[model samples]
Target: MAEQVTLYTNPMSRGRIVRWMLEEIGQPYKTEWLAYGPQMKSADFTAINPLGKVPAIRHGATVVTETPAILAYLADAFPQAGLAPAPADRGNYYRWLFFTSGPVESAVISQACGFTVPDDRRPMVGFVDMQRMMDIIASAITANPYVAGDAFSAADIYIASHLSFSTRVGSVGSRPVFADYIARMTDRDAFRRASAIDDEARAAQASKG
Candidate 1:
């Protein structure tokens, strides 16, 4: 028997990404919905994630946090799902995965929050040039159907999710390549199931207010 997996998440957070990955892995996992603020900061929750963040997962005795880390962990835990490239072929997989978690995430959040990096300090920031960053992403997505390479992998999930959110929030300028990539990556059964579950949860949460 497989070890039980539990997802601690809020419907509206990046937990949705983990939801999608879980669906793709076809694993039976339990979802514990947490409201922001009090519920998330509660001691019980903090014991699982010291940062009081949603989107942490418990698989048997292991605890995994951080969106990208969770995705990578699930892919490795369920290799039959083929969400990760073979170990020797993970150069681009690890590259784009951490790239999205680092530079892409940093740039989008900073831009959306109206924070600007000083021109002199551009070198210090990983995603200093917005245009250049988007161009690089576009090149990668357009170069192949997937981010890592010819095969769809966990990297695609993180990349597509980030681009979808960034474009929707106006943090990143809309581009045909981005839209195309998101559409292709999300037009899967797993993605649809995950989105529907989250949408329903989101509606239910809103109705409670």
Candidate 2:
């Protein structure tokens, strides 16, 4: 049976990541593209995700929000996708997952929005600084073909999304390491199919106005 998954997302948002996950899932799914401002903040949408964020998915009765959570859920929910590493290799699997999802995300978004802590209070920031955090990510990917040692996992999806966005926003340098890793990840057939759909959707939405 086809999976009954409803993806509620904004065409131009992090929803692309969930779309990629859906493509990787290789199951029939529906998408309810949402508009920003009032539409996203509407009561119905808020009931799905209190924060009114895109990339939220409704799988059966389970609703998952946040990019990392959604991706991880899909990986587990669709074991045939081969999105998770073996049990033994999961040590680094989860380590980088939380790291990229938490501190690294804060660092990148905060810097992009001009939100920063003072020098004295910088220590309170888990990532400390964007450059340092990115350097850590770069070194890790440079050493391994994938984030969690050898296997390709949902962890790669989260980290790769961050790296791609970080480069666009100038949060991280466009070093060869970052570019090479992204190239490797994005080249996957699943990613290509998902991104093509998102790109078309975004273009169509833009042309409407």
Candidate 3:
């Protein structure tokens, strides 16, 4: 039986990444937009995700949270999408995908807040510092066309979303590699369609007030 996928999200939240991924994968999904504050904390929605976060997915009877996990799950479930890397390429695939969610995101958030790991724990940190993480990511793209090598997979969606979000939030400076990556990802028809729909929805809500 084909799985039924439903996404609960808000456009302004991290859920946007999942939204883009859904569009890229061309899966049919039902979206429930939750407003902030009391609406998101409502009992009905809270049951699905105790954390009251957006981007939760109901696939059949299973509920999945966390952006990276959702991305990985969708890719595997829909093999026809060609988003998952083959078992042979699992090493690079998992490395870049998890790196974006783990170190790269952590480093960006920490740097934005002007925080750093204690000197003694620096080596234990996945990303010693934002600059180092940025340098490594930039070098990877310059060295290889894609995050997990030549093939574009779900890893690209995750990495591209992070790079795009980082650049937009000023966490990442305007570098050529960042600029190039964003340009390429945004140029995709799927991305453009999702972005346009989100923009329209936001505009409609604004005009109602």
Total clashing pairs for each candidate? 0, 0, 0
Query: What is the C-alpha local distance difference test score of each model?
Result: 0.92, 0.85, 0.82
The 10-residue segment with the lowest total lDDT in model 3: 140-149
lDDT of 3 by residue, 1-209 (tens): 28778989887777777877888889788888888788898999999999888889998998999999998988888888887778788787788889888989888888888886789988888775677788888877666777777777778888888888888878888788888987876678878878877777777767877
lDDT of 1 by residue, 1-209 (tens): 39978999999899999999999999799999999999999999999999999899999999999999999999999999999999999999999899889998888788778898988898888885788889988898888768888899999999999999989988899999899999999999999999999999999999999
Best by lDDT: 1
Better of 2 and 3 by lDDT: 2
Q: Which residue runs does candidate 1 get wrong by more than 4 Å?
A: none
Q: Which of the numbered candidates is closest to the native, going by highest TM-score?
A: 1
Residue 161, candidate 2: C-alpha displacement in angstroms: 1.6
> What ranking emerges by TM-score with the best candidate at the front?
1, 2, 3
Assess the local accuracy of residue 87 in candidate 2 as a C-alpha lDDT between 0 and 100.
Answer: 69
Candidate 2 local lDDT, 1-209, one digit each (tens): 24588999877888888888788878899999999889898999999999887879998889999888888888888888888887676888788888988988888778778996999987776877777887888887877889988778888887888789778777777888888898898888989998888899889999999
* lDDT score, candidate 2, position 143: 77
Q: What's the TM for model 3? A: 0.93
